[model samples]
Target chain A: MKFKAFLTDNGVSLLEKRFLPALDKMGRICHLYLTKDHAFFLHNLLNGDGVQSIAQFRKESLFEDYRISSQNDDRIAFTIDLGLLHRALRSSVSVCGHVTTATNRLQVKLVKKLTHNSQQPMPFLTFESKGYKSAVIQDVPISKPLSRVDVVELQSAIDMAQDLPQTLVQGPDLHQLQSFVDRLKHVGDLLHITITQYGDLHLQLLNTLTTLGVEFRKLPVVGVQAHVPSGDQNMTAQSRTKYAVEKGEALSVQVSLKHFAKSLQCHLTKPDCAFYGITPLASCLTVIFQFFIPGTRQTDKSISLHCRLPVLDPGSA
Target chain B: MSSSEADPDIPDLVCQLDNVQGMVDALSSVRWKRHQDSVLELSEHGIVVIVEESGCLQAKVYLKKELFVSYEYRAEGRPRFGVSLGVFVDCLNTFSVSGRSSSIEICYPGPDMQLLLKSVDTPDACIYAEIRTKVPDTISWDYNFEPAGSTPLSFTVKSAALKEAIDDLEWPGSSIQIVLQPDPPCVQFRGEGHGDLQIDFMYYANTDLLIAFQCDRLVSYRYKYKFLRATTSNMPGSVIKDNRGSKLTIGRGGMLKVQHLVSVARPSTQHPHIDSAAYQQPSRIAYIEFFVKPEVDEEPVNDA
Candidate 1:
C-alpha cells in the first residue's frame, strides 16, 4: 500500500481549522477512508451507539497531487486519533504566515517507522511542511489498515447511513438553535423533534414537571420531490401541498438531548444552511450541512457533512 | 380545558411583561442551588417568590404589578404554588434574546394547574413552556425582623463593593464577623481561620462606597460565611452594573437582613416608539431580601 498527497492552501485551512476540529468534538478516534475519487472522515460508523458523522471531500478539492495504491481496489481505511491529527495540521500551517503566499508547502504520506525497543514496525501518518525560516514535521500514529472483509463492511455501513428521509426541511439559524438547546439541557434529557411537510419544525422537551417547546414556521422545504418514491404523480409541488393538507400529521422522533447537542457542533464550519430529516419509523434524525459560494446561493460541493443521530425509544421518553 | 370553560366569575391570573431579562435577573439572584424549590404567591399587587435554605437562610423576590406591561388578576385571593427555581429561571431565559427585548405572557392554572409561559411577539416563531406546580407547603419559619436597637442599626453600601468583599473573604473562615462602630461610623467584616481578612468601609472616607450609616451604638455579630455568601453570590450583573446600594440591617436576635434592588425597566432602546415621558416614571424595580441567622453560640458584642 502506498499513499501520498500535497495539500492546497484552501485544503489546509479547511482541514486544520474547520473539518478536523469539528470531527474532534464528535469523537476521539475517527476512520479516515481514502478512495480514488474522495476522502471521508467517518466517526462511529460501525458502532451502534453515539452520533455517526460522515464528512466527505472530493480528492481534487483538498489535494493537488494525490496518489494511492492498494490491493483492495485502491481503497485504504484506518482509524487515527482526531486530536493528534488536528494538532499536527495546526502546527504545520501556523508556522508559516500567509498560507497563500508563504513559501510553505505541506506534504502528507503514510510510512512505517522502526522503533529500537520494538521489533515490529508501526505505521504513522507524517506531515512535513517546509517554511522559509524553519521546517516542521509531525508524526501521528495510526491503526493498521483494515482487512478486505472489514473494508467491505465499512463500505456497506456508509451506504446504509447515506439513505435520506422522504422529507427534508431547512432548519433555523444554528446560533439560535444552539442557545435554545442549551436552555433545554437544563430541563430534560430527551428531545422530541417534529417536522411537517408544510415547513414547520417543532422541538419539545418534556419532563415530569414542565413541557417546553419551540416552533419555527414557514421554513423552506428541500429535496422533497427527489426523495419521494416513484410512480407517485402526487409528489409534485402542488400535489405535495394538497397531500399535506389532507394529512396534517407530522413525522416525530424522540432523540437523546446529548446526542442532538453533539451533532450541532457541525455549525462551527459556518455552513450557509442546514436541512433536517427524520426516518419514518423513528430510526434516526439526519442533519445535512450545506455550504454556499461566497457571492452566490450555489452550493459548494467540494465539502459536505451529514450526521445520523440515533433516535431513542419513544416509549422510554 | 380552557379558561373559558371555567367559572366566568373567577378569571385566571394572566400577566404580561415586556422586560423578560429584568425578571430573569431578579429570579436568578436567589437561585443558590440547582434544585431549590421556590414558592410563588400571586395577588393583585404583584408576585412574591420565597425560597429558603435549611430553615436558616430565606430570600424573597418582590415583582410588583407595575413591572409588567399588563396585569390581569381575577383570583378571589392570593394563590400559592411551588416550582423548581432552576427550571423556572431557565424557561424565562429562553424568552430573552440577547440585544432584543421580547414580551412574555404568563398564566397560571393551566388545565392541570401547570404554569404556562409564552412569548408574545415574534409572529414567525413562538416559544412556549408549561411548568407543573405543586401545592405549596406552609413556610417553615417566618421571622419578623424588628430593629435591634433604637437607632435602627443599618448600613447601606455599594452592591458591587459589598459583593466583592464577601467573595474575597470566603477563603479565610467558615464564619464571618460583622462589626459596626458608632464612634468612627464604619463597618468591618473580619474572617478568621487559617488566615485573617478584614475589609472596612468608613462613612467619611468614601461616601459613595458606604452609601449610608445609621447607628447609635456599636454592635457586632457572627454569621455563617456560607449563608452570607449566598446573599451576594448570585446577584445579577445588571444590579452590579447599575451600582445600586445594598442595605444590611441587624434585626432582633442577631438576624441579618440583606436587601437589593433590581430595576425592571423596559429598555428604551428596544421600544424607540414609546415616549420618554412614560420611561421616566421612576423605572419600576424588583426588591430582593435575604435573611440569615447569626451563629447560635455567638453573642453580640455591645459597646454602647
Candidate 2:
C-alpha cells in the first residue's frame, strides 16, 4: 500500500510555519495517518491536556495525486518528530516535491531539479521507523508506526474535540488581545478565560492578590451546523447568528500567562488570522488558529491549527 | 508591509531595522549565565543590557535608539526589568525565516509588564513574554573598568583573521595569553595548557583588514578563556562576513576593550525621503563593544 502527497514549497511552508506552531502548543511528536480521501494528523498527549486532530482534505489540483491502497482497512499511521519533520519539510528548494511511504520508510523527495546545479544528486530526505530499522543508533530517537490502541486513542481525541463546544472570537485585534493578557500577567500570572452566554470571550488575570478582566463583546457567531470552517481561515466570520450562543452558559479555562502567550504564536505569520477557543466544561482548554494557503486552482488549501494546553487551576488541582 | 499598516496596537516601544540579527549579535558580546536575572532597562535611548561575571569582568551592550527605524517609549520613567533571555530570542527568531519580509514592534505598558513583540511582516505573527521586574537588580555585580580613557596598547584587526587565529589554536588550554610589544612580532596571542602554542598578527599601514595599530609600551596579559569563550560563542557567523572591522584596546591595569560595528547600511542614495541631515546614513553605525577584565597575572611578580 502506498500514500503520496505532491508537497509544494507552499505546503512545506504550511508544515514549517503553521504546523510547528500548533505542535509547539501541544507535544513533541505527532502521528500522521493517511486514508483514501484525506490525511489526518492526530496527537493524543499523555499529560491529560486532551487530544488534537488536524484533517487536510486532498486537493487534487495542488497535489500530483493523494492515493491510498485499495486494500480493505489499509490506512497507515506513522509517528514523527514534529520539529524535525518541520525542518526536513523546509530543506527543499523545489517548487514540487513528493512524500511517499514505501519499504517502511517515509521519503520526502524534492523532485524539481534546479537547472543551474547538474552536479548535485536529486535531493531526498528519509525518516526510518523503528519497525523498519533492524539496528538502532544509541540515544537517537527512532519514530515508529502507531499501534492499534494508539490509533483508537487519537481517533477518540479527535471525536472529543469535535464533540466539544467551541467559541469563535472576533472584533478584537489579536495583537491587542495578546498585549492585554500579557500586561495583566504582571499583577497576576494565572489567566482565566471564560465565554459568557452572550458570545463574549472574557479574559481575566486572576491570582489571590489581584483580579483584572476584559470582555470582548458581541463577537458575531456562525450558524451551529458543524463542519471544518471555511478554508479562508483568517477571514472574519460574516455569517450573522441565525443562532445565538446559549446565554448565561459560561465555560471557563485557566492557564498560566506564559502558556496563553506561547499558544498565540501560530497566528503571527498569517495576517488575517482567526482564533477559536475550545473549552469543554473543565477537563482542558484548546485553541485553534486557522489560516489558508493563499493560491490554489480548484480548491481551498486551508489549515486549522489545534493546540491543547493543560488547565492547571490551583483550586481545581 | 510596513509596521504602521499592520494594526499592531499603539506600541509603547516600536523599533524596526532592516534586520534584527545585528542586535542579537551585539547581545552575544555580553556573558549570559551570571546576568540571567538582570532586568533589561529600556529608556528613550534604547535597551541597556549589562552582563557581568564575578565582580571583576563585565560587558555592556547598548541596542541604541538610533539603530531602530522607529522608536517610541510611552512609558513615563525608565523601565527596568529582566526577561527570560532564551524565550525573548525565540520570539524574534520567527521573523528570521527566509524570503519572509518582516517589520517588528516591541510593546510594553510599564516595567514588570508583559513584553509583547509583533512582527508586521511575516504572517503578522506576535510573541508574548512574561518579564519579571521584581528581581531586575538580582545581578548586582557592577565592575567599573573605566574603559573610556587612554589605554596602553590599542590596535584594529580584521574580525575574520582574529576568529580564524583563535579557531586555529589548539584550544586544549586553561586560559589565553596575549602579549603586545614593540618587537618584530608586534602582537602575540598564545594558548597555554598542556603546551604553549603562539601565533603572530602583523600590522599594515593602510588596509581595510587592519584598520589601525597603536602600540604604547611593552605589556603582557593572561585571561581565562572560559569566560571569554562563553562570550564569543554567541557571535553568529553571518554577521562576521559583513566585514565589520574590530578594534582591540588594552587599557591601563589589564582593562581590555573590543569594539566592532556590525550593521550593513543600505546606501543613502536608495532612500529618497531619508532626512539626510537628521539621519546620516553613514553615522548609522551599530557598534558592539566588550570590556573584558584581564585575569590576575599568576606568574611571579618580580620575574622579568
Candidate 3:
C-alpha cells in the first residue's frame, strides 16, 4: 500500500493506531521509516542476528539514518506490497511498519510487483488460517477554513473610512491623530485573530500569515547615536609623545509628536543614543525609521551603535 | 485475544506485573559466594614473606638491607660466614577451576643444614601481624619467591537460574593480608641466625570478591661450629656460626571478575551503579601500588 507522511497531530495518531498495528499484524516491517518517538517503542520487535525482531532492526539501522526531526517542515513516506506483508506477518517474528496488507484474493500481477527489485525475491505463499482476518482502517477527520480573517478585516476597515471628513476645521493635527488611532485598533484586532487561530496549527503559520499580509511596527523610543570625542586642539609634549587617541559618544533622537504629552523621540528610546556611545549634541548620526503594524508596542529601548575611530599605540606609530 | 487461538508459543498468561510476585518468591533462593586474595611482603634483609598467596612456595627471605656485612673468623678458620646468595622463585600462576589443585612453595638451598617453615590461615585474614627470627651475628643470603593459587573462584548465576531470579545468585567481597615480620631482618635480635629461607601461599576469590589465603611460613636455620678464631691471634673453642641468608616473594590481589549476562530485572537493578551521574564524569586517580617479586638467579658461585 502507498504511504504518506503524517503532518498533523491527528494524522500522526492515525498512523500509529491504524497503519503501524496493521502492518505489525500482517508482519511486513522491513524497509520502513518511523519518527524517533515511534521507532523508540517499536525497536524491540524485529528479528536478526543481534537484532531480536524487525522493530529492533528498524530502530537501530533505519531510524539512525532515516528518521527526520519533526522540527523541520520535511515529509517522510513509506511503501509496502501485499505479498511481502503476508509472508512477514506469517513468520514467527513480530512485524511492524506503515500500511499492513493481507493476501486472500490472489493476483499474479500484484504478486509479481511485490517481489520485483526486492533484496530477497521469493515466491508468494498462501497465508490464510482460522481466526486470521484483515484489519480495517479508517481515515482521520480534518477541516480546512475557506478564507482567512485578516483579508476581511482589511477590506472592511478601508470601506468604513471612506465617509470620514477630509477637512481640518477641528484641527488637521487632531484629525490625523484620530485616523492613526483608528488604523492602530484595526491592525491590533487582525493580529489577535491570526495568533489565536493558526498559531498552534504548524510552524508555517507565522511565516504564512506574513506572506499573505500582516505587519507589526515597534513604537519609537530613545536610542543611541555615535560621535567622535571633542577635545582641546592643543596637547602637552608628553601627551603628543604618543599617537592620537580616538573616542566615541552616544546621543538621543529628539522628535516632536503633536499628540504626545511631552517631547517624544521618533526613535525607539532615549536610551538608544547612549547605548551606541553618541553624546546628546552629536549630530553626526541620523535616526533610522522603522515600519511595523500599529499593534506592536515598544518591548525594549532601541540602541544605535558605531565604532570608535582607530587609535594607534605610540610604539606602533 | 482468545487463549485457544493465540500462538501456542505464547504462554497461557503473559503477565508483566506478575514478575514482581515471582521475585518475591525468589527472596529465599539464597546462592552462596566465595572470595580470596594473595599477599606478599619483602623484608629489608632481602627476605620475602608471602602469606596465603595464589599458590604454594610464596615466601620472603632477608639477605642484606644496605650491603654492609662484618666478618667473624672461626677459631679453626674454615669456610667463612657472609656468603653471597640468590633466591629463585619458579612460578606464581593463577588458579584455574579445571586444573589440578596447587599451593605455595618455598625453598632454601644453603651450606647450613636444618630449616624450619611455618604457616597459618586466620579467619577473615584481616589481622596485621609480623614474624621475628633469632640468629647469630653476620649471617647473609639473598632469595626471591612468588605466590601461586588454586583456580580463581567466582560465582555466576546459571541461565536457568537467571530465567527465574537473579537476586538468588551470590556476590563477592574484597580480600586482604598482612605480613607478620619485622621491617628489616638485618638488625640484631632478628631472624639473623638463619639463611636461605622462603615462604608461599594460595589465594581464592569467592562470590563476594573476598580472597582467602592458605600461607606457610618457613625458616632455614644453617650454621657451622669451628674450633678457634684463626684470623685474630689464635684462640681455641670459638665457633663462627652466623645468620647469613634470606629470600622474599611479593603477591598482589587480582581484579574482581564481573558477570556479563544480565537478566532484564538484573540490568534495572545493577545498571544504576554504572549509569549514575556521579560516575559519568571523569576524575583523577589518587594512588596506585604494584607489588611483584622478582625470581631468584641460581647461577653457581665459585668457591675459591
Candidate 4:
C-alpha cells in the first residue's frame, strides 16, 4: 500500500506547469516567503473534504525525494513515501488516500507492462519515483442511531394523553342492562314491577277500586288565584265589578305533574329542586303515586311513575 | 500702422471680402428649404406657412385679423372658404433686374394679405381695404357685411376693372394647395363637378370648437392633418387634448379625407344668446386659409 494522488488535465496544468516547479526550486524558502500552507491549501480547496493535514504530509519518511513534473501534455506526477503511506492507506480513516493509491498503482503497472511488451512508449505516465502506488477508496463515516432524548419525548406525549375521557366502552355489561329495561313490562306483579325514568311522570297511573264500581280522581297539582292590580295607566277611574257566579257548576279535576324534575336535577347536578317547580297537592290522594325511581346503587338505573284516586264527595265532606 | 499710411488696396480687399461675406449671408437667407409645424413645400421655392394657433382665445383674436381669409361666391352650392397660392410678388423682386417686370398688380398675395390684416392696428369695427392681388386688369375686390345695428356692411366692385385684371394675370404653370379647416365636429362635405375641376365647400375647423368654418374641400392625397385643440372646459380634470400643442401628421396623405370629428361643445346655458346668432347659424363655420404654389410639372416631394 502507498499514498497516491492523481490529477486531471486541468489539475496537472495548474500544478506541474505553474506551482510545482516554483515549489521544487524554493522548497522551505518558498514555504517561508509565501503563505505557509500553499500546497495543502490548494489541495484542500480542490478536493474539498478529503485532503490530510499539512503536518501529516511533511512528516512522511520519503518527503524529500518526491517527483513532480508536467509530462508532455497536461499530466502531473507526484511521488509519496510508499511504506508510511501504505500504513495510512490500510487505515479505515484514510480511505480517500487509499483509493488514489490503489487506482494509480494499477494504472502505472498496466502502462509499464504495455510499454515493455510493445515497441513504443505507452500512452500513460511511467513514474520513476519509489513511493507513488496505493489503492483509492470512498471515504465517508457511517450515520449514528437515534438518541434517548427523542424516544423519551415521544413516550412522554403518549403518557400525557392517557387521562382523556374514554372514547369507546369495551364490554358486554351495557348490552345486558339495555335488554333488562326493554323486557321489564313482562316481570311479575308481586315484584311490584314498575317501569320509570330518572325524572317526573307526565301521565296518570290507573288505580283499581276493589270495593266500589265508580272510580274517583285525585289532584296531583294545586291552584290558587289572587287579584292583581294593573301596573300602569289610570286603574282608579276604571270600573271594577264583583259578583257571585250566576250558578256554581261542577269543575273537572285534572293533574299537572312535573315531567322534567329529575332531568333538571341531573342536568344541574344539585341536591335541591332549584331547577324544578315543586308544587303541593290541593286534594289528598286515596292512593300513592310513585314520582320517580332513583338509579340502582350498584348499576345506576332510574325509573318514574304516577298513580291516582278519588277525593271525598261533597256530601261526605 | 498709421490710419492714412495704410494701403488703399487693403481697404479694397476688405470691401471685396465684405461683399463675398454678404453674398454668403444672402445665399443663406434665401432658404430653399424650411421645416415648420404646418408646411406647404414647393420644390426649390419657398413654402406657404400656416401656423395653427392653439388656444380658443388666441384663435379668435387671430381670426379677427385678416389671418382669416374669406371668399364668397354664390355658385349653386353652399358657402365655403378656399385659398390658393401664386408666386409671392415679393419673390419677383429678386428677378426684377434680370429684365422681367410684372405686367399685373400682384397687390395682395395670400401670405401678405394674411400677415398685413393680422398685424394691422384697425379697430374691430373699422374696415380697411387691405389690398390682395390687384391683377392690374384681371379681378376686382369687394367688401360686404350686414352690421349689428342699422348700418350695412357694403362692398362695391368694378366689373370692368375686375375683368381686365383677371385677363392680365398669367398663371403659366402653377400648383395650388388648400388646407381644409373643419369645424371641431362638423364633417359635412358636398362634392360636385362635371370633369377635372370639382368644387366642394366642406365645413371644417381647428380643434377649438370656437374656430370653425366651411372651406373648399381639395383633399386628394390621404394625409393626417392636425388642427388646434378644442378647449374642454367641461372635462372635470385638466383638459385632455389629443394634439395639445403638437402637430398631427396625417399619415402619408392617407388621412387627407376628413370624415370623423372630435369636438367639445360649449356649455349652452352660461353663454346662451350671448353668441347664439354667431354660433348657431346653421351653415356657420370659421377657418384660416392659405395656399401653396409649386412649379407645375415638378413632382411633389415625398416628406422625409
Please give each candidate's TM-score. Answer: 0.91, 0.56, 0.14, 0.12
Candidate 4 segments whose C-alpha is farther than 4 A from its true place: A1-317, B1-62, B65-266, B282-285, B294-304
| Chain B vs. true chain B: TM-score per candidate | 0.93, 0.77, 0.14, 0.18
Prediction 3 TM-score vs. true: 0.14
| Candidate 1, position B230, lDDT | 94
What lDDT score belongs to each candidate, Candidate 1 first? 0.84, 0.53, 0.20, 0.20
Model 4 residue B2 lDDT?
A: 13
- State fnat for each of the candidate structures: 0.76, 0.00, 0.00, 0.00
lDDT of 3: 0.20
Q: Encode model 2's per-residue lDDT on A136-185: one tens digit a residue.
A: 11111224445667656665665666644455554356666665555554
How well is each residue in A217-270 modelled by candidate 1, as lDDT tens digits?
678886553233344322323233334334643567788999999889998877
lDDT of 3 by residue, A98-122 (tens): 3222422111111112344666533
* Better-scoring candidate (TM-score), 1 or 2: 1
Which scores greater on lDDT, model 1 or model 2? 1
Per-residue lDDT tens digits of candidate 4, residues B56-92? 0111101111111222211222111112111221222
Top candidate when judged by lDDT against the true structure = 1
Question: If both were scored by lDDT, which would come out higher, candidate 2 or candidate 3?
Answer: 2
Runs with alpha carbons beyond 4 Å of true place in candidate 3: A6-40, A45-317, B1-294, B300-304
Tell me, by TM-score, which candidate is best: 1
* Candidate 4 Cα lDDT to native: 0.20
